[model samples]
Target chain A: MFDISFENAKLFKDCVDAIVNLINEGEFEISSEGITLRAMDPSQIAMVDFKMPKKACSSYKVEGDVKIGVNFEDLSRVMGRARPEESLNLKLKDSRLEMTFKGKFTRRFNLPLLDIGGTVPKEPKIEFDANIKLNASVLKDSLKDASLVSSHVVLSIDKNSFVIEATGDRGDVLIETKKEETVVIAHECTNNAKAMFPLEYLNDILKGADSSTVITLYLKTDAPLKVEYPVGQAEIVYYLAPRIENV
Target chain B: MFDISFENAKLFKDCVDAIVNLINEGEFEISSEGITLRAMDPSQIAMVDFKMPKKACSSYKVEGDVKIGVNFEDLSRVMGRARPEESLNLKLKDSRLEMTFKGKFTRRFNLPLLDIGGTVPKEPKIEFDANIKLNASVLKDSLKDASLVSSHVVLSIDKNSFVIEATGDRGDVLIETKKEETVVIAHECTNNAKAMFPLEYLNDILKGADSSTVITLYLKTDAPLKVEYPVGQAEIVYYLAPRIENV
Candidate 1:
C-alpha cells in the first residue's frame, strides 16, 4: 500500500505533461525514495526519464516498492483540471489509483490500473562532443521559426556559436546564438558537432518547460540529443534520435 | 479618395472581430461620419449593425461616400496580426484596400475588393417590454453554463430578477440574478418578458465584449432580442430572432 500527497498539483501535473506527448502508457515505480518513470515513444524515436524525490512531497508512505501502470492521456486530462493552488493526494485502493484535490472544495477521481507488460528500456550511452545551457524560450522560438520552412532542424555547435537551420521549398530559417549572448547561460565545445532531428518531437519535448527555465543540451555528430530540465523539484530528461542524412 | 488612420489598431481589430462571426462578407459604407456596416447572417436569423465615429480616428479624409465590399474572414485574419500598440493606416488604392501597420517595423497588406451584391437589411422595430443592463461576463458565463445541458436557453426577466434556464438529456442549468445583485446594473419590467435563443449565436455575439463591459439587453415575449455593447469608441448592435416555442 502507498499513499502520497503534494502541497500543490503543479509538480505532478507537469511531470505527466512531460511524458504524455511521447509515451501513451507507462509504468510508475513508487518506493520510499519517491516516484520514477522511464518510457519510450511507440515509434522508439524518443524516450523520457522522470524522477520526483520523497523530499518534494508533503507526505509519503509506502510498505514496499510497487509498480503501477497507467494511461498517460487519461491521467493528463484529470490533472489538467487541478487549479494552481490546489493540493493533490494519491492512494492505491482496490487495484485502482484514487486522486483527490483539496482546495475550496474536495474533488476525487478514480482511474483503473492497466496490466501493461514490458521491461524498462535501457538508457543509451553516448560520449557527447559539446554541451550548452540556454533559456528554454530561445529553443522554443527557434523550433517554431524552423517549422515554417521545414519538418526538421539541424542543431550545430562550435567554439563560437550555436545555430539552428532549416531549409524547405517555401524558404529557409537560420538562428545563430553567439556565446556572448545572455540567453546562452553556458557553452563548452571540444569539437564541432551537428545533427538533424524531427521538429515535431523536439517541440513536444519542450512543452513542459517554462520559457525562463534553463535547459541543458548534449550533442554529437550523427548521435542522439540529450535534454535535461527541472520541473519544480523534479527532474525530467529526454533523449531523441537524430535523423541521419539519406537514411 | 478616402484615407483614415487610427492611433492604434485595437479599435479597428475589435470592430472586425465583432462582425466576422455573424456576417461572412459585408459592404462597409465610408464617409465623413467614419465607417458603418449593416448585414444579416446567411440563415437570416441574426443581423449586425456596427459604427465607428470619425472622432475615434487620428486622421480622417473623404471626398464622397463610398461602399467597399470585403470578406470578413480575410480581414479578420490580417487584422489579427496587428500588435496592440501598432498604428493602423487604411486607404483605398486602385479599387483595393491598402492596410499598413506601423510600429518598429512597417507591414502592409493589399486586399482585393469583392462585389458582394446585397442591399442592406432594415432594422426591425420592436417595443421591448423589459430592458436590463448587466456585466457582460455574467451573461457570457450563463450562456456557457446553459450550453452544457442544451443547445438553447430561455431568458426571462420579471419584476425582481433575470433568469437563464436550459434543460436537456444531460441535465439542467438555472442561473438567476436578482435586481439587487451588483451584476445587474439596471433592470425595468413593465411586463414579464421571456424568449428562447440559440446558444451558439448568443455565444458568438458576446465574443468581442470584455468581461467588464456593460451590455444592454431588450426583450419581449416571443420577440427578437436586441443587444448593444461598445468596442472602444465604436458601437456594436445585434438583433437575434427568437426560436418560437411551438409551430
Candidate 2:
C-alpha cells in the first residue's frame, strides 16, 4: 500500500503547478525516503527536478519502491477543484491514482496513469560561475515586467548587482537589485555571467510563488540558467537553456 | 468636452466586466443624465444594456449629446491593470478615449474609437409571465455547478420554488430553492415558466456578483431571459435568447 497525506492541500497543488508546465508527464519514484521526479521538457530546452521528503507530509507510508507515471494535466485539473482549506490524501491503486480532498465535503478523483515507457534521463551537468539568492517576489515581479516588453529576458550579474532586462518594440524594462537590498540573500560571482532565456517559461515556473519565499539562481555565460525554490518542504529546481543568436 | 471621474476604479471595471463577453464594441451615449450603452452580441444571442448615471461618478461633465464607439476588450485590458483603490478619470479627446488610473503610479491609456456607422438598436421588448428575485451568489453558484455538467441550463419556476437543472453525458445537477430559502427575495408566477439558456453567457454576466447583490430574473416560456443587477449606482441588464432543442 502506498499512501500519503498533507494537512494543506494547497501545498501539494502548488508543488504540482511548479512543474506541470515544464513537463507534461513524469515518472515519480516513491520510496521511504521521499518522492522524486526529474524530467526534461519535450523541446529539450528545459529540465525540471523536484524532491519532497517524507517528513514534508503529515503522514507517509509505503511498502516498497514504487514508480508511478502520471499525466500532469489530469493531476492539475483535479487539484484545481480542491478547496483552499481542504486536506489531501493521495493513494496508488492498481493503474489509477486516487486523490481525495477532505474538508466539509469529501471530493475524490481517480486519475489514470500514463505509460512512460521506462525512459530514464540522466542528470544534467552544467557549470556555473555565479549564484544569486533573492526573494521570489522580486523575480516574479521582474518577470511580469519583462513579459510586457519581450518574449525573452536577459539576466546578467555584475560584481554587486543582478539585473533583469527585456527589450521589445513596445518598450524596454530593466530591474536591478543591488546587494544592499534586503531582497538579495547572497550574491557570489567569480566573473560576470549573462544569458537570455524565454520569459514565458520563467513566468510559468513562478506562478505559485509569493513574496515571502526565497529563490536561488545559478547562471553561466551562454548556458542554461537554474532557478531553485521551495514548495512546502519540497525543493523544486528548473533549468532553462539560453537562446543563441544565429546558432 | 466629455469627462467623467470615478472615485473607485473597480466599480467601473466591474460594470465593463459584466458585459464585455457578450458585446465586443458598443456605442455609448453621453448626456446630462449619465452614460448609457445598448448593444447586441454579434450572433444576436444576447443583448446588453448599461446605464451609469451622473450620480455614479464623483464628477461628470458633458457639453452636449456625444456618441462614442468603444471596444470593450481594449477597455477591459486597461481596467485589468488598475488597482482596486485607484480612482479613474475618463476623457474624450479628438475621437480618442483616454483613461487614467491614479494610484502609486499613474498609468494612462488612449483607446481609439470605432466607427459604428450611426446604428442604434431599439430597446428589446419581451412579455414575461414570471418574475423572480434572488441573491446573486445563489445564481452564480448554481451556474458554476451547472457548467460542470452541461453548457446549457434549464430554469423553471413553479408555485413554491425556483429550480435550475443541467444534464449532460458527464452527469446531471439540480438546484432547487424553496420559497423560504431567504435567498429568494421575491417570486411571482401565475403559471410555470421553463426555458433553457446558454450557461456561459449567464456566467459572464454574473462574474462580479456577490452574495449581497440582488439579481432579478424575468422569464417566459421559450423566450429570452432578462437578468438585471446593480453596479454601484448603475443598473446593468442582460437579455439572453433561449436555445431551442434540435433547432
How much TM-score does chain B earn in each model?
Answer: 0.98, 0.93
lDDT of 1 by residue, B1-247 (tens): 8889999998899999999989998999998898999999889999999999999999999889989999888788767767769898989988878787775434556677889876899989999999999889989988989999999999999999999999999999999999999888999999999999999999889988989989999999999999999999999999999999766
Cα deviation of A52 in candidate 1 (Å)?
Answer: 28
- Candidate 2: residue A142 Cα off by (Å): 2.5
Clashes of each: 0, 0
Stretches off by above 4 angstroms in model 2 are A168-173, B1-247
Tell me the docking grade of candidate 2. incorrect
- The fnat scores of all predictions, in order, read 0.00, 0.00
Clashing pairs in 2: none
Q: After superposition, how far is residue B233 of candidate 1 from its true place, in Å?
A: 0.3
- Give the alpha carbon lDDT tens digit for every residue of B77-110 in model 2: 8888889789999998767999999988898889
lDDT of 1 by residue, A1-247 (tens): 9989999998899889888988999999998898999999999999999999999999999889989999999999999999979999999989999999999999999999999987998889999999999889878866775676579999999998898877765434566777877778999999999999999999999998989989999999999999999988999999999999894
DockQ of all predictions against the true structure, Cα-based? 0.04, 0.05
- Poorest lDDT segment (10 consecutive residues) of candidate 2 chain B: B166-175
User: After superposing the true interface residues, what Cα RMSD does each candidate give?
Assistant: 8.6, 6.9
